[model samples]
Target: MSTISETYTVTGMTCGHCVASVTEEVGAIDGVTNVAVDLPTGAVTVTSTKPVSVDAVRAAVDEAGYSLV
Candidate 1:
């Protein structure tokens, strides 16, 4: 299967715990293969087997206590 990578900007993530939280929530989504967070830039990159919807990613970020931009 081909993997897709999408990057999103998130606000309010300031530390490792924040990174872990975002990573865990996004990683739980269906078809998600990987979740990478760049704390310095508020960039969250998600790799999945299919294109994940922006709303789903936003919801996951919200659940993680962050805002997706």
Candidate 2:
């Protein structure tokens, strides 16, 4: 399988807990191999084996009490 990486901006993340929450939620998505959250910049990098939909990522962020910008 090929690795795919995508970066998305998120809002409402201000600390380490926020980072962890985003990571856990996004990482739970199917095909997701890794989730990296940059709290200072609110940039989330999702690495997966397949293309993950934007809607899926948005929903995951929402589920974590944040918004995908």
Candidate 3:
């Protein structure tokens, strides 16, 4: 299957726990194959078999107690 990568700006990620939380939530999404978080920059890059819904991502980030900007 083809994969699509997307970068999102996430806020409130101040530590490793934040990164892990965001990663866990986002990774739980269907088709998500990879999750990379740049803590310093709050850049979250997600790779999936299909285009992930922004709303889903936003909700996931929210679940992690963060915000996707």
Candidate 4:
């Protein structure tokens, strides 16, 4: 399996709970294997077994009421 990591500047994460919510939502995608969010930095890291496309990731973030900046 291929491993890939991506960092996204996410908007709308104001607290740890928001981070957790975003993490869960993104992690639920089929290709996503791991997720980490730093609320203070507004950074979201995603690990996947395959090459997870930016559009797919952005769509998931958008669905969760957030934006991938």
Best-fitting candidate, measured by lDDT? 1
Work out how many backbone clashes candidate 3 has.
0
Q: In model 1, how large is the Cα lDDT of residue 57?
A: 99
lDDT of 1 by residue, 1-57 (tens): 889999999999999999999999999999999999999999999999998999999
Indicate whether candidate 2 or candidate 4 has the larger lDDT. 2
In model 2, which regions exceed 4 Å deviation? none
Over the stretch 1-69, how does candidate 2's per-residue lDDT look in tens digits? 789999999999988999999999999999999998888899999999999999999999999999998
lDDT (tens digit, per residue) of candidate 3 on 1-69: 789999999989999999999999999999899999999999999999988999999999999999989
How much lDDT does candidate 1 score? Answer: 0.96
Worst 10 residues of 2 by lDDT: 35-44
lDDT (C-alpha, whole model) for all candidates = 0.96, 0.96, 0.96, 0.87
lDDT of 2: 0.96
RMSD of 3: 0.6
What ranking emerges by TM-score with the best candidate at the front?
1, 2, 3, 4
Residue 13 lDDT (model 3)? 96
lDDT of 4 by residue, 28-53 (tens): 88889999898888889999988888
Give the TM-scores of the predictions, in the order they appear: 0.97, 0.97, 0.97, 0.89
